[model samples]
Target: MSDTLHPLRVSNDALDDGAELRARMADDGYVFIRRLFDPDAVLDLRREMLQVMQAGGWLAAGTDPMDGIADVSRQCTEGDPEYPQVYHEVYKLQAFHEAGHWPQILDVMGKIIDAPVLPHPQKIARLWFPKFTRHTTPVHQDFVHFQGSFDTYTCWAPVGDCPVELGGLAVAPGTHNVGAVVDHRFSLGAGQLQADAQDVPWLTTDYEPGDALLFHSLTLHKALPNLTEDRLRVSLDNRYQAADAPIAEHMLAPHLTQDAPGAITWDDVYADWTDDRLQYYWTERGGPVVPRDTSYSDRGFADALARAKRGDADARLHLERALRRDPDSDRGRQAAAALQADEAPSR
Candidate 1:
């Protein structure tokens, strides 16, 4: 971060009441801190995510094919091995859905969001994106690219120490309050707000494998190009929204897009009815991909679980709406269970 950045300070400690994390998010729209996962856990997840991507198959060209994984790694930390193709392959592995219910993510995330008091059923997944010279995420708000809205959090956790060489992320924090405005000259990315305007809370910090960074829906953020040859950047985006949330009309558009890639096999783990008629509401509520994406005012999350258990077709819409992102993930068998549960049961 430039020394000119706003001189605000965070506890950077293990977390007590979670007030510190919440306050920073409520006030700034973004927060960068360490300690989302342990060293060993981060290493393990890194290896697993890479392997999962390899198993998912790859696109003929372009990184968007691996955007989910790269995005997570960017939010967390990763480096590319070589230009054009740092990673042999990278993709959003469906396996991470199992991470949704992990105890580590639940206990830590629950504390931050004040769950139980808020009481969310909690869902999790890793959105991976691999990047290289030929494929880098263009500067754009996530809402611009995906069918989902910005009403949910995209908690980003690094699988390893994320240095600049490793495709570190740069953020224009607090600028999130400024809606999706184009034109870099007037955009925070260009750094030309008002003459007397406050310097954007810009930062380009290196995070350890276990560290995490959280950002809001409107925040201005982008991933650094993978300049490090041989290092691969693999991360996760844990999305969340309130239960019973509607499906984003934007997301369903893919069903309408002629050349859009194949659709995800949305599996509803909770017992419920699958209703394609149900809408997938776009959301951008969670704080960031790393910190506390959300904290409910009541037990809306609990009610959501009940709706899902009864066989709700749009569970993915709701789960993505209220998810609690996790860092310690290697779901070989665990992921299988989550995906299995997500499927509709036989009569």
Candidate 2:
């Protein structure tokens, strides 16, 4: 699926030039910087994350955890029941959360935003398994998921060297210039939604450790499928915005905490943390918080219900996940109803 890929324009040359960085971000909707972070630091964090996975039996026996040799039998994603069991353990890593606030990233984001920047509290990590191409992240604007301001930026960086076969992110340059959210439909991908981004030229590269791809919230982007035989593709998906810009209320919590089966809480995440400095540090910072718009997800669910009625297997799986995640929630109840309707005998 990554057959047609162009090299991203390297923006490290303008690292110190705020005017040039802002100019390029305005023109291309993204800034690709090679080795944006210290390679050793990235590797250190990768070791920490993968070790947690290894402990959870997600990695192959006798293999070094640092190699990220995934046990494909344990291939489950965010929506799957098994994912949270291990993911919540990884979430407790202090280093993992600290990586989101790395000074270099903050510095560049401030320059691009032309204001003091706030690294979003709900930091995310994509721990993708190989041979799981069907669950690869789909094309869509970040606004559909992170909703706050169109000025919000997602800074994605791999935890280790990520070749094309390992599946990193790619962007359709200047797509954010559309200046508005486009139509999205149900998807079995990470976000459970996909935007149609056909016929557009895609830009990506064989990303090395510390390389970062920063893009606007409304930019069209997706992950290239991981086609490797055994390795897991791990990456950071942290968001940032002007310190005074509005933020969605959900962005204040730990990422995907509500979506996790038992619903992970900040207290659970901080119980073992040795440092408390970053804990709730954003409470006094950031701009006014606003409620999240549910329209995007509401439409996606509607699409899934229709598709499931027509016997779409992926749609059925998505709904099944919703039901299993929280049967008492409103969406979970709707999923149950739709599934029951689909299973009813034809009259």
Give each model's clash number.
72, 0
Q: What lDDT is reached at residue 88 by model 1?
A: 21
Candidate achieving the largest TM-score? 2
Worst 10 residues of 1 by lDDT: 185-194
Question: Judged by lDDT against the true structure, how good is candidate 1?
Answer: 0.42
The lDDT for every candidate, in the order shown, is 0.42, 0.92
Clashing pairs in 2: none
lDDT per residue as tens, model 1, 74-175:
322121112113222222222333343345555545554554211122222222233443334324443332313344444566666666656555566666
Candidate 2, residue 92: lDDT: 90
Candidate that would win on lDDT:
2
Q: List residue ranges in candidate 1 displaced over 4 A.
A: 1-11, 52-95, 107-131, 145-151, 179-201, 244-347
Error of 2 at 53 (Å): 0.4
Predicted candidate 2 versus true structure: per-residue lDDT over 167-254, tens digit per residue:
9999999999999999999999999999998899999999999999999999999999999999999999999998889999899887
